[model samples]
Target chain A: MQINLPSLDGTENITAVCMRPDRYTRLYEALTCDTPVIARGGGLSYCNAGAGRGCRTVVSTCFDRILAFDAEKRLLTVEPGMRLGDLFEFAVRHGLYFPVLPGHPSITVGGCAGFNVHGKTQHNVGHFIDYVERFTLFHPDHGEITCSRTDHESLFRLTIGGFGLTGYITNITLRLIPLKGRSVLFQKRFVANLKEAVEVMKQLSEKVDVLYSWNNLNKTGDAFGEGIVFSEQFIDEETSARDKPFHLFTPDMRSVLRFNFYYRPSAHMECAVYYNMERLTGVEKRCALKATAFPIHGKEIYYLLFGKQGLREYQMLIPHDEWAGALDDLRALMNRMKMPLTLGSMKFFTGAQDLLNYRGDGICLVLDVPANRNSVEYFNKLDEIVIAHKGVVNLSKDSRLTAGTVATMFPEYERFKNELNEFDPKKRFNSALRMRIDV
Target chain B: MSDKKTAVVIGASSGVGRAMARELAYRGYRLVLVARDRAELDILAGDLRIRAKVEAVVSPLDLAAATTSGIQEFVARCAADHPAIERVAITAGQVSDDDQGPTPLPLLESIVKTNYLAVIELVAGFARHMEQHAGGTIAVCSSIAAATPRGRNTVYSSAKAGLETYCRGLQHHYRDTPVRIQAFALGYVDTAMSFGQKLLFPAASAEDTARYMADKMSTDFRVGFYPRFWRPIVMVLAHLPWGVYKRMKF
Candidate 1:
C-alpha cells in the first residue's frame, strides 16, 4: 500500500526524471547518478533496453529536440526524442531522405541507433547506424562523449545494436543522402514455390533497391507457400517530375482487417470476427456476425492457434546461397507440423558494419508466433532448422529464441558482453531475455 | 471530489483503466496504479506523475492468482499511507471469446469474483478504514452490454449486470452517508484489449469517458453513462419490452 512506484518496469526506476531539463548541465547531472541508467525512446523495443531491470534509474530521452539541420552538408543534429517518421518527413522536405527506417512509424532516432534497425532497402544501403556523422552521448562513467567512425570508434561501434547498454544517447548527427526522386516504383509479385520464390527474390534483389516478401504459410493448394514479393526503386529526376511523390496512406477497413487477420491475429475469435465483419461487411452484416461471434475473441485463440502464453518472434538471417534451402525446409516443416504461421517471409539487407548484424549477404526469414504452449514444439523445430544453416538471429525481435541458438547466432557475442559489462558492471539492466541471452 | 483526493486504479496500464487513471490524475488526485505489465504502467505512471504533479504508486501483479490477497493488503496500506484515498476504481475485467465449449460456470464465477466480489471485498476493507474518518467513493466498471443479453458474451454480460445491480443497491444502502457508490456503464472504447473488434454503437474514447465520469463524481450522480447523451437513449431502450428490443438489432 505504501510502496514506491517506479516509473516503468524492466531495468530502471525512471520516475524521478521524466521531464525536460532546462540546461545540458542539469541533464548531465541526472545522468551521472550512482544508479545505473539507460536512455529510452519510443519504448517500442520488445526487450528491456528502454526499461532495463533492477537499475536504480532510467533517463527517458524521448523529449529531445532537433537543435539544427545543415541542408548543405546533408546532416541533421537532433535530440533523441525526434521520431524516425518526423525525421524522414524533414528530410523529404529538403529533397533528401533518411535511407533507413523500420516498419513502425513511432520508433525514435535514438532507438534506431540503439538497435541499428534495418529497413526493406537495407540490402542496398545498410543499417541506419552507418549514416551517422557522429553522436554526443552522456555516460555516467565517461561524462559527455562524442563518438563517430573517426572519433570514439569502439564506442560508436558498440552503440549500434547495443540496446542502450553503452549509455544515454543525447544528440546524434545523422548523414542524409540525396533522394533521386520522391517517387518510388512499387510492384508486388506472387511466388509459387519455395525455389521459385527464392529465385524471383534473387533476381529482384539485383534489379531493385528495396525488396521484401510476405508468405501465407497456412493457405493450401496452388497458393500454398505462395507469397507476395514487394519491390521498390527510386525514380530519377525526370521520372519524379512525371510521377507523384509517394504519399503515405492509412489502409481502409477491409485492408486493415485483412492485414490484422493474416498478419498477427489476436487470441480472440470474436475480435477477429468483429474486425473482419465490421470492416469487410456492411453494417447489417456486422450486427449479424456480432450475434454469432459475441464472445468469439479471447485467450483461447492466442493460446491455441498462435503459440504459447507469451509474445514470440524469431528472426534469422540466411546467406544468399542457403536461402532456397532454408525456405524449402521452412515450407516442409510448416506443412509437416500443420502449424499456422501468421507470417513467414524473407527480407534483403545491404549489409551492416556491426559484426552481429543479422542482415548480412542474404535473405532473413522473420516469423512472428504467438506465445502459446501448444506452439512450443513447432518453434523448437524451426529453431533447429535455422541453426543448421549457420544463420544469425536478431535478438531485438526475438522473445522465444533459446540461449544456445543466440550464442551460436551472434558472432560478436563475447565482445558485446564485454562492452555491456563495462557500462553496467553490476548487471543491473537484466530482464528475462537479457538473462537468457547473457547480455 | 474531496480536495486533494486520492484513488487507486487496477489494470491502469491501458484501455479503460488507463483512461480512468489519467482522468483522476488530471483532476489533481493522487493515484495508486496497478497492472500486470510493468513497462506500460511505469510509462503511464511516469507521465501522470510529471504532467499532473500527482503522487503515483505502480504495482504490477497477476490478478488471477492466489497471491492477490496481497493486493488487498496493498490497498489497505495505500489508504493508510495517503489519507486522501477517498475513491477506489475497479476496472480490471477482461473479455475472452474462445471456443472452449460453452462458457463454463467456473469461468463465469471467476468473472463475478473479479468484477464483483473482489470489488465488494476491496470496498469492505477500504470502507471500514474510511468509515472511522470521512466517507469516500467506490466506482465499479460495468459494461453497457449488461443492459441487453447477447449470444457470445453471456457470462460476461451477466457478471456485469450483477455488478451494476449490486452497485445500485449499495448506493441505496449508503444513502445519506458520506460514502458514494458509482457504476460506470461503459460502451466500447478504442483500446488495445478491443483493438480488432468493431462496436455496434458509436464508441466513446476512453479519455472522454473518464473525464465525464470523473467530473460527475463530484456531483450527486451515482450512475454515469459515458457520452452523457447515451444515458437517456439507453435508459429508454433498456425499458423497452423484450418483444421489441429483441426484435431490433443492437
Candidate 2:
C-alpha cells in the first residue's frame, strides 16, 4: 500500500507508507500498529502535512460516506474522508449547504477541520471549525473518544486546527446552512490598488454572499494590486429558473502547462493578458455555485506551472490597522528582491484567535512565487515583515516556515505543544509539518 | 414502488469486492453484501444505502467455513427477499505467506477450501438458483498465478488453477442455458492480497478493476484476464518449454 505521493505544491515528494482502511476495525489496526502515524485524507495539502519520513500514512479515502442526517436540526454526521464537493452535492439535494469550503472540491472534511480552512465567506461565516458540532477521535493511547463543545471541551478545541497531531479524526458532525438556491448572480469590479481592493471587499461583505479580490502582483509602483474584485449573491428560486443549466465541477488531469512556464519576463505579460481577458468579459453573469466555489477544478494546471521545482505560497493575515503598511513593505521588498509574483489574492477574515487556527479580523493576502534562490531569501525576509506587523502565516499552506517564526506569530504556540504532549505523551501521531516545526 | 435489480457480492468487505459493491450500487442495484467480517460489511452496507440510496443487506457468511447447504440456503433467502436477483459476483480468495515449500497441512487445506472448493459450491448454488428465474450473471475472480505457478505460492496457485478449470467446465455446460458465467483471471490487484509483495508490474487499483468489471457485465465475454494485457503474458508463460519455465524464478 506504500506509494510515492506529492504535495499539491509539488515541492515535496514523499515515499508514503499508506494504508487505505475502509472499516473501523481496519482503521484501528492501522492506528495501533506501533509506528509513527498520521491521518491522510485526499493527500491534497499544499505542504506534506499528512506524510512524513519513517511514518505510516493512514489513508481514509475509502471511509467516505454519510453516516447519519437529522433533517430538522440541519445537521449531518459524515465519515472523515468524504470530499467537500460530494458533501455539497448531497446537501443541495436536501435544500441545505455547508458554506465554509476551500476552493478545491477534492479537499476532505477532515482536511478542513485539521487545518481550520477558510473560504471566500470567511468574514461572514468564519472557519470550518465553527460548523463542526462534534467528532470522534481515535488515539493509540486513549482509545476512541467523543469530543464536543460541552464534553471533552479542551480536546475539541485542540483537535481542530491541530493539523492531525492530536489523533485520527474518525467521523464529524457538522451543522449545515440552509441553502436558498444553487444559482448565484456574480459580478466583477475593477480595483486600482491593494488598499482599494481591501476596502471594496470589506464593503461588499455586508451585502454579498461571497467576496474576494484577485490582484495583479506583476505590476509595480502605483499600479500594484490592480485587478478585479468579484462579488456574488444567491439567486432566489424564481430568478434561478431563467439561469443557465448548472453542472457540478469535476477535476480533470489533462494540463496545458506541460513545461515550466513561469519566469520574470513572461510573468508580467501573462498577468496583463489575464486581467484584460477578465476585464473584457461580462461585468455581470449567472453562474453555478459549485463553479464559483471551486474555480480551480478545471484549471489544476496552475499548480504545475512552476514545473518540478514547484512554487511557494506565502499566505498571511494582517490586522486592519497594519495591512496598508505591510503591503507597502512587501511591495518594496519585491522590487528589491526581483521576486516574480505568479499569483496574488486577498479575502477579508473575521474571527477571534484560537490555538494555532488562522483566524483574526484582518485581510488575508496570498502570494504565489516560483521556488528559486532569490524567492527563498525573499520569503525569509517577508516572514520578518509579517512578524513585525503582528500577522500570522497559514501553517497548512507554507512548508518552509521555521518553528521560531511560528512561535512569534502565534502567541499560543507553547500552549498548543504542551497540550498535545499531555494528551499524547508518546507522540503516536506525527507529520512532516510537525517535524519541520519541531512541535 | 421502485423496481430495481439486485446484486449479490461475496467477500464485499475489502478490495475489489468492496469497490464492485459500490459500482453495482451506483448502477442502481440493491445489494446483498456477503463477507466474513460483520463490522466491515455493516459499514459498506450503510455507505451504499446512504450514498447510492439503494437497499443494502449485509450477510456475514465465512466462505471458508460455509457449507454447501448453507450457501444454497443463503441464496434462497436472497431470492425470496429480493426476487429480482440479476447478478452475483464471487470475489473471495485466500493465500498464506507460509504456503511456500512444505507448508503445514492445515494451511494448505484452508487455502484449498477457501479458494477452490468454496467457490465451486457457490457457483453451483447460484447457477441452480438463477436457472429457476430469468437467468443471471455469475462472475468469479481467479488469479493469474493459476497460469504460471511459482515456487513462492505453491498451494495457492494449484488451488486457483483448479478453480479456473472448474469455472471453464461450468461455462461450457451452461452454454445451452440462459445462465451466464464469467471467470476473471486477475493480475496483481492493488488489494490486501498483493499489498506488500514486490510485483513484476504496477498493480491495478481495486477501483479501476471494479470499473472494468462493471463495464463488462453487460457483455458476452465469458473467460478473460483482467487488465487485458495479462492475457498475452499468461499465454506466453504457459506455452514456454518446461526446461525454460523451470529455470525461471518469479
Candidate 3:
C-alpha cells in the first residue's frame, strides 16, 4: 500500500488490519503471525515520528470515535486517532478547553501523547502530559494496561514522551481546562534582534499566557534574528458569552495556495507583509481562540511548499545560562553559511521530562531549514553548538537524528535506553527516529 | 450484474484502483475502496454513491501499519456489508526501487515491502474470503518490466517477478478449486511513475488498464497483458539470453 502523509513517505502493503478503534486484535495478529506492528494515529507527523524505516505491519486507529466524556470531571476519553483540532472543537462545544494544541490542526491525541507536544504557552503552563489524566497502552506482551500519574507512575511518565515505542496508546483521558468565553487578546511587538528579544520575552512570559518570537533567519548584519515577538492572553475579562470562531477558507484560495507552493512558497512574501503590517500598528487586538491557538491552520500548504526533498525542523532547547553565547555563535554560522532558514520560532519551556525528553526550563529555538540543499551539514554544525550548550533537540519534530547527537544532547539517553530495553525487550514498538537514535 | 457481487479495489483513492472502482460501479457491482486518507475515501464514496449509484464502502487503511489478521478483519467487515465479494483487484504498488543513486537499505527494502508483501497478504486475505464463497476473481496488476530482471530497478523487478511466481503457485494450489487469478503483465502505463521517462512504446492509460482488467477478470487464462498486444513482445524478451539481456538498458 502506498501512503503519503505530509512529509513522511511510507511504502508498505501495510500488512495489518483497519479495524474499528475499539479492539486490540492487532497485537494478537502481530504476535500470532510473527510480525512487527506499529501503531498509526492521524498520520500528521512531519517526519517518520509515527512511522518506521522500511516497512512494518501498521495497526491504524483511523476508525476514531469519542468513547466517553464526563462533563462533571471535565475529562474526555477519546480514541487516540482523534485530531487535536477536532478535540479543540469538541472541548469548546462543551464550554471547556484542551490547551496542548499543536500549531498543526491534523495532529492526533496519540501523537500529542507520544511526543509530549507543547503549545506557545508552554512556559506559563506545561506540555501535553500535564493535561493527560490516564491512557490505555496495549503492550505487545503485557496486553492492555491503564497507566496514569498514580498507578504505574513510571510507565505513565515514560509513555508520555516515549515516541510510541512503549506500545499502542489506544485511548487517552485528557483533563480539560476551562475556556474563557472563546476570546483572546493578542499583542505583537517588533524586536530588532535576539539579544534584545531575550529580555523582552522573559518579561512578556510573566505577563502573557503565551509568548513566542518568529525570527527572520534570512536577514543578516544588524537585522540578524530581527523578528516580531507576539503574546496572547484570554480577554474574556470584559466580554461575556463569547462564541468560538472557526474560520473555514474558501476552496479557490486553498487551490491557489496548493498550486503556488509547487512553484515556490508565496507564504514567505505573505509573512514579510504580516511582519511589516504588525510593525506599523504595534498594538494589541482582540481575536478568536482558534485564531490565537492555531495560527498556522493551513499548514498543509507549508508541507507542500517544501516539495519532494522535504524539510527538517532543528528544534533545540537552549538553557537560560547558555542561550546568550550559543545563539550568537548560531547566528554567526547562519550568516556565514547563508543557510536557508525558511521559518524560525523561539519560545520558553518551563518544564522537564525524563526519557527522550525535549522539555526543559529554558528557551527553545526551532529552525525550519529546508532540506533542498546540503542543509544537513548546517544542522550537524548546529548540533555541535547545541552539544556545547547542553541543549536537547525536539525528538518529535526532528528529521535526521543520530546516536551521537542523541547521546550528547540528552544526558538521560543511557537510562532511557536501559529502561526501554527492560519494558520492550522484543522491541515490538519501533519507528524511524527510534532507529536513528538507536533506542 | 447483481449488487451482491462486490468488487474490492485495494488502491481506490487514486490511479488504477480509482479508475477500476468507477469501472466496477458502472458494471453494477458494489465496491470496497481501500486507502489511507479517510477524508478522500469519504468524498469518493459519496460521489460514487451519487454518480455511480453503487454501494461504495470506504475502508480507510494505512497498509504500512496493518498485519495479516488485521487485513482479515478488514475483509470480514466488508463481507459483513456487501456479502458476496466476486472480485478483488490489487493495483496498489509503488516503483520507488530506482537504485540509480545511493539508496538507503530501509528505502530499498520498501520496494519488496510495497510491491510484494502488501499485495500478497491482501490476496491471501481476500482470496480466502472469496474461496469460501466458492466464486470470485483475483486480478493483480503487475508490470512488463518484471518479465526480465534489471539492475536499474532491482528491488521492484525482483519483487514483481516474485509476485508473479506467488500467483502461479496459488494457481497450482487452487487448480482443482474454482478460484481464478489474473496476473496482469502490463506494458508502459502513463502514470506518475512513467512520467518524464522516455517510453520505448506507447504507454496505456490507467483507465484502459482498469477497463481491460475489470472486463477480462473472470477469463480462464491466468496471465493477462494490458493493451493485449504486449503478450508477444514481453514473451520474446522473457526468453532472451541473459548475456544479451544484461547489456540492454530499459
- Per-prediction TM-score to the true structure, in the order listed: 0.54, 0.88, 0.60
Error of 1 at A199 (Å): 1.7
lDDT of 2 by residue, A382-422 (tens): 89999989999998888788889889899999999999889
Instruction: Compose the digit string of candidate 1's lDDT tens values, residues B213-244.
Output: 77767766787667666677778878999788
Q: Give candidate 1's error at residue B131 in angstroms.
A: 55
Model 1 chain B, TM?
Answer: 0.86
Model 2 Cα lDDT, one tens digit per residue, B1-250: 2347889999898889998998999899989999999987887898788777899999999987888788778877877877778899889888888999877998988888888888888888888878888888899898899999888788999988898899889889889888888888899897877764677876887878998888777777788898889999999999999999989988
Which regions in candidate 1 have their CA more than 4 angstroms from the true location?
A: A1-30, A56-61, A220-224, A236-311, A352-354, A427-433, B1-250
The order of the candidates by lDDT, greatest first, is 2, 3, 1
lDDT of 1 by residue, A1-439 (tens): 0111121111112232232232355456656655555565655554445543444334343243455567789888876766665676567667787877776455678888877888766778788777988998766657779999989888888887777767777778999999766565656676775456667887877887667776656655556556666676665433213322122211111122212222223322333343344335432211111111111122223223321123455677887777667867876787786644655667775564245555677677776554445466777787788777767777666555666767676677777778778766865343434555677
Residues A347-437 of candidate 3 have per-residue lDDT tens digits of 9987764678788878889877556446678888889898888788887676677888788778899988988889988887776667778
List the TM values for chain B, per candidate: 0.86, 0.95, 0.91
- List candidate 3 stretches off by more than 4 Å: A2-33, A54-61, A237-271, A280-282, B1-250
The backbone clash count of each candidate, in order, is 29, 0, 14
Query: Model 3's DockQ?
Result: 0.02
RMSD in angstroms, candidate 3? 13.2
Best of the candidates, DockQ: 2
The recovered share of true contacts, given per candidate in order, is 0.00, 0.41, 0.00
